[model samples]
Structure formats: C-alpha cells, structure tokens
Target: MNTNVTPLTTVSRGGDAVLFAIEMRGKKLTCSITREALEAHFWLERQANEARLLRAFSDGRKRIVAIAERKARRLATEVIKLTSQDFER
Candidate 1:
C-alpha cells in the first residue's frame, strides 16, 4: 500500500480533532475526526514522562497491549481511505 497520512490538528475547548488528507492514483481522500479517541494514545505515549516520578517499574515484558493498539491504528488508517466504515454524520 502506498499510504502516507500527515495528521493536522485543531484544538478547542471541548477537545481536539485531526484531519488526514491523501492523494493517490488521481484520487483525493480526506478524513475528519470529530471527537478523537485519544485516551489510549495519550496514555501509551506518556511512559517517558512517568518514568521520572516512579522509582521502580516493570518494562511490560509481555506485548499484549500492542495487539489492541495495532488494531486501533488500522482503524484510524482506514479513515484515510475515506471508507464508509469511518464516516460520521
């Protein structure tokens, strides 16, 4: 798949939304996220900051969570395709 999506963001009082646009094979596709589900991503990305406060922690040897995030990324990727599955009223 020749796919590349650069996320652009807009922040507001309620929350944020990311826009992804793609052009491929003479076709244009756009994805608008009304209410971004950011909890999982924010939490996962906070490991570096949290490390300073905690003295000891586990490295999460098992990669169970990757399975879920992988699926999540796939869903988000599909949005760039402008697939009906990601459309919202």
Candidate 2:
C-alpha cells in the first residue's frame, strides 16, 4: 500500500501480550506481540519489566511493523497479533 507505519504513544499490558497501535494511511490499527515472542525474537528477557519490554519493542519497531503490515494484508484485519511462531522460518 506504500504506507508507512507510525507507532502510537500508548502501550499497555494485555494479559500475556503488549498492546500497541500503528497508524497507516490515517487509520490506527491495534497491534500486539506476545511476551514470549518478544523474548524469543526481540532479545527481550523472560522476566522483563514493562520498561524493558518497551525498549525491546522500540529497538525492533521497524521489523515488527513490517511483519504486522504483512499479516494485516494477508488476514484483512485491523488487529495484528504476533506470537513466537510468527518468527519461525
């Protein structure tokens, strides 16, 4: 779609995942990646705090959003959730 993803300000804990958002073409899409995914894919610690998790997310933001966009395109959904399996080749 030739759109860029801009991360939203608010990030929250959603059970075992971190809930966040990304704006694409003026629309905000809810996105999340599991704690397990973060640990396995983003170099996050298993017992990380929220700050650490946020840092890991920020560091890997580009790759994360790219995958999310692909998932959104394939699934045609407004919500994108990433699990550890999403990272497996």
Candidate 3:
C-alpha cells in the first residue's frame, strides 16, 4: 500500500481538532488529531480558536502526519484519529 500525506490541513468542523488528507492506493482518506493532543503534545493553548489550533497543527505537521501514517498502516483504516496517547511513544 503506497501512502502519501499531503501538507494541506484544516481545522475540523467543530473546531476541536485538525483534519488532514492522506492519499493511499489512489484514495483520499481523512485523519484528525484532537485539540487535547495538540494542547498536550503540540503546545496548543486552552480554549484556542480555530486559527491557533490550525497553527499548532501546521507547526507540528511533520511529526503529526508521521504518527498518523504509522497508525493508518498498522490499523489499515480509512479514517485515523490521533489522540494524545498516540504520541506517548
């Protein structure tokens, strides 16, 4: 399975997470990282608005996407949701 994670990222609809796209086997999949994960791992502030959350995600995009890709490979799912626990290792 070939996978490529794009740099394009956006805040989730509810503004509680950041969503990004992953292209795998000619299909696009959506993945997300919770605001809690951003706060704990990506230095996001409490009650941050969409802008701040997006900035945090952009700043940590590389690491975040790497983890998301790993999860996607291991779990083999169409959607990946990364929480704070995903970064524990």
Which candidate number maximizes TM-score?
Answer: 3
* Residue-wise C-alpha lDDT for candidate 1, range 30-63, written one tens digit per residue: 5433232232322223323323211111222112
Per-model TM-score on C-alpha atoms? 0.32, 0.83, 0.86
Per residue, candidate 3 scores C-alpha lDDT tens digits across 1-89 of 46787878888777888889988778677899999999999899999988889899989987987888789789988899999999996
- Candidates sorted by lDDT, best first: 3, 2, 1
Please list the C-alpha lDDT of all candidates, in the order they appear: 0.31, 0.78, 0.87
By summed lDDT, the worst window of 10 consecutive residues in model 3 runs over 1-10
Better of 2 and 3 by lDDT: 3
Candidate 1 lDDT trough over 10 residues, lowest sum: 53-62
- Model 2, residue 43: C-alpha shift (Å): 1.0
How high a TM-score does candidate 1 get?
Answer: 0.32
**lDDT value, candidate 2, whole model:** 0.78
- In the predicted model 1, the residue pairs found to clash are none
